[model samples]
Target chain A: MKFVLALVALVALAFVPSFAGPYPLGLGIGVLGYGVLATAWAMFSGPTRYISLATVAFFGLGAYTVAVLSETLPYPVVLFVAAVIGLVVALIVGLATLRLAGIYFVIFTFGLTELVRQLVTYYEVNVTRTLGRYVFLPLGPEHIYWQLLALLAATLGMAYWVRQSRIGLALRVIGDDPVVASHLGIRITRTKLTLFSISCVIMTLAGAIQAPRWTYIEPSIVFNPTTSFLVVIMALLGGPNRLFGPLLGAVPLFLLFEWLSANFPNHYSIILGLLFIAIVFVLPNGVLAAGESLWTRLSRREART
Target chain B: MTTISRRTVLQGMGVSALATALSGLPVLAQDRTAIRIGYAISKTGPNAAGAGISTTPNYLLWVDDVNKAGGITLSKLGVTLPIEVTEYDDRSTAEETVRAIERLATQDNVDLILPTWGTGANLASGPTFDRFGYPQLAGTAVTDMAPDLVKRWKHSFWMLGGGHDYAEALVALLVKQRDAGTINNKVAIASVADGFGIDLSKAATPAFTEAGFELVYDKTYPLGTSDFAPVISEVAGLGVDTFVAFSYPPDTFALTQQSVVANFSPKVFYLGVGTAFPIYPGIAGPNHNGVMGIGGIDPDSEALAAYFERHTALNGQAPDNWASAVTYASLEILAQAIERVGDIDREAISAEISSGEFDTIIGKVKLVDNQLRSLWTVGQWQDGKFVGLAHTERAGAREPVVPKPAWVPAA
Candidate 1:
């Protein structure tokens, strides 16, 4: 029943650009892009209990890949190259930091983004002699929206598949107790690295699809650390335990951002900060979990009556 | 037991999102009697300080002034239309700036579009405005890419002097000072590590070397740097007699504050962008005297005095020394172009702007190939006021104070 409903939702989203205006379509594109980032991130980080804060590093890698290669290659081929780059970089980073855990791993991944940002900044300044690359893709708002939606669908499908697979069970065991999982014959290192690499590939593909919308790519804008933090916050806010939780968090959160930015442009950040604090304090588990609790309580009351 | 499925929640969200989007449609309707001019400015971000003094107030003043006289008189149409401004705070990010410009163009369908706050924002939005066929008369953008951008985008015009031009002018003044034995040949230069600062530094570095000045200390700091004491101490340790800082507003204030704390006083201390702002003098106090920076106005002009009074009356603050005149002058140019063409057709207005000359508060304004050719490239602070020291044409240029007086201690 859930599968059938999910399929219907995906099909409906695929046709959104047909009826929606450019503004809504643009907002949809942003929401879908964030959905991919948050969902794919939650897919690996949720089950493994490893907080990966390097979303922007992969996102920027993909954006720059498209920025540099899109001029010569097709858009789809550029996305493929970006995914490959994301996979390779994530494999190296995951291996080097796999031994570390807890706050150390979080800090390492956070530092990785800043290191990558500075390196890219230096390369652009010294080698390119240009402030940023100008992307001249012919894709319009609708095309970009469709591309982002397709990526989101693929990401959600992957997450659902991962949730049902044997590897998902193994990841959950490791997240619960790594020593016990290892003693039970689970290959902890390889499985975690694989999941991390796959998640990064999805993130990079999303970034590649969204890059043309920007039309120009600079290191600071593309590789912003704030984007990485926003992805993690969205996942945590939506409930990282469930596959669709991040999507639920991302859509409404992004819409709220757009609405607040349009209305209270000056106080948008402050309002957003307060909302984040309120969610953390009240809905500690996430909005999805809180809603489920409310539903459960109401059903129990009805049953009692 | 009743349960809420994830699918149900997703469907509900989709319905609500659609409803919200549909409801947002009515806000974009056009007002026919008003000439809608849209702009994305940095009202509350890193670039806010620059935009606060240089761009936004001038825009408001222009709108108020135009509407006060009933409206802009279109000689060709024999009718007047009041100006209506649609503004969005860009949050000082390129992505937000681009999105806001896109909204203004595609959603709002504004009659004319103003430039974003800084060089990067302007460059990011240039293609969008060009694609939409809106005339972009940039006010605060300063980049050497202006020539290429103007050529690439037909409707775009760069109002300020190019970075290379300004760098060359500053270097020329330094060379003159060096030749006159006003300052030593050794200099220290620092720049903010953004597009604007990087471009200025890149242009000035070679120019300084080519003009026979030894760069004793050189480095670039990141934007929003709170501590300049370390860099200032290093520059001071180099025993350099001249200091040149390519900076934005925040860093301009930070560097000056740190320099005073460290007592890193150079004989010729020249900071960029924000040095010409009124707040710089107000904050730096006695230390502001003898400092030189980018852009200037004729301090003695009655027009400038009147602009200051009107700006203070309207906005409760004085305009910045550098881009305020140029920003207002660009609006004046736009108003005159609209009057000449007598319509809001973007192509006609762009053509008139490309071919026409108009008198403004800044004097006779003419664009050579869509770039402002004759303007003050540099200014120096003397007696608490920024006076134009270098102009493209030296006719009305004020003589720069040589061997700048020592920094006075705060009272």
Candidate 2:
């Protein structure tokens, strides 16, 4: 059933390039790009850990990897390489902070993201253009969409594997109770760092994909707080613990945002904000979680009868 | 057992169903009478302040005035008809802006579309409009890559001069002064790091070098820079007489204020679009007494002045910047095209816009051989106002205020 659903989604998205107009296609590309980031974000930020807003740091790193690599190869190849590079860097980042508790890891990621943005801005402004010798290349929007799609698929697939694997159970145990897991010899620090690095790798791929989509990128887009907020909302909307939850959140929310903006003409935020606040308040586990649990309970009642 | 909650659920469903049904109700522009126009502008986030001040207010006034005068003269139909503008706020984001524009173009089926101010928002909407083949006349976006975009999207026309156009104008103004030998100007430089400024600075280098000006000090700082004391001190020490900065509102204001505070004021300060905006002069005040700017054409512009005056009188506000004039001119040109094409038809409007020349409030409007030929040129700030100063007589800024009313210095 899962494979069938995943296959259907892939087929729909594959042809999306041909059928969707630039406007719709551009929005699809954006949602998928962010969806991948949010899904990777969910790798650590599920209700288990409560790691809020850490995805942006990893996302920014991923974006920068593409910008740095795009000069040598095509953007799509640069993105693939960016995913690998992200994994490597994430390994390093995760190793350093995985020992820490909730707030420390969160703060670590925040500080690192801001630091990366500042460094990139300084390098681009002072060194890259000024030197005239070290110019950074920019990409067009269509090239960006394809790259984003590739990254989205890779990140989603990786998340699915983690969902069904032993490592996934270990991460869940760490998320549930790191103190208990430490006693059981789970090497809590090692496990966290590995997960953090993996998350960062996926984020990097998303960023690598986006560089060409907007034609121009700066620190703001890659490491934006707004992006962090959207990813959180996406993950939560999709039911953070569930696989493909971010996709559910990102696509529907983005498509709805576009549809509302187009039809109602800019009266989206008030509605979206209200909807978010209401849902979070009333549906504690989110749409996917609450709906799935209800279905499960009803099926159990029928089985007993 | 819980019929009340069940009833409430049904009620909520009923409300949502009603809302959806009402939403689908034809928001389409009704045919006949007022020619429908659409404007998508950023009105919410970071860039919203730019639009609220610059673009939207001007649009309201332009539409009102055209309505007050009965309507635009429909040349083909030979009857003046009212113009309607279906307005949407893009919420100051690229994603939102593009969505708004698509709705306006597709559903509202507006006779014309005008996108608001900023590089990011405009760039996002460019391909969308190009695909739809709507002749989007962008008023305030400084998209340097527009000439290439124009190839794919022929219907699109940019009212404001290109970034390079502005660059050459600044360089030309400095050259004219240098040739005349009043100002000790020998350098063309800037303090903007964003794409707008960097691209302009890069393009203008060859022109400045060709014109024999010394390339003294060109620097770009990050956006939201605090104290530009170091860059300023360096440029002042280098004796870089003309400080050229291409920036948006805040950065432009910051650079100017820092220059003033640091007391490193150059002799002939030139800027990109920021200098032309009315907001900048107010922010800089008398400190902006002797600056030059690269800007679009505004008629000796009683039509626009009246547009501004009426806007001020009605809303207790002045037109935000020269963008008001450009957006107003764009709609005026578009209306002339539609009316010339006669009945509501897309191809006819395109053909008319491509091969039509009609008089507008902003002098004569013509898309000669498919290029928007309503001319544009640079202007200088003479006593706080951006007075049209270059090739005005030839470009038609000449009149009773002939050669620009004494207070305006010759460029």
Q: Name the 10 consecutive residues with the lowest summed lDDT in model 1 chain A.
A: A123-132
| Candidate 1 chain B, run of 10 with poorest lDDT | B1-10
Clashing pairs in 2: A62-A204, A90-A197, A94-A193
DockQ versus reference, model 2 = 0.24
The CAPRI-style docking tier of model 2 reads acceptable
Query: Could you say which candidate leads in TM-score?
Result: 1
Residue-wise lDDT of candidate 2 within B1-411, one digit each (tens)? 333443443355346545533543445646567778787776667777767766777677767877887887767666777877787767665555665676666556676777777665665566667657777677766655666656756766666555666666556766767777645645747656665666677778778888888888766776677666777787878876666776656767777777777776566776666677766667776666556666634545677677667768865767644566666777776766776666666667776766777676566766544444344456666655676655422442421111122112212
Tell me how each candidate scores on DockQ against the true complex.
0.32, 0.24
Cα lDDT tens digits for candidate 2, A1-305 = 97798778776777776755554565666677778877888877772474656677667666666656667887558767777877876777666666767788677767777776777667877666531111134544455676667667777788888887867888888888877877888777666666677777777767665554433355554567667777877777777788877777776666555555655666667876876675466555555776676679779999999
Give candidate 1's error at residue B329 in angstroms.
Answer: 1.4
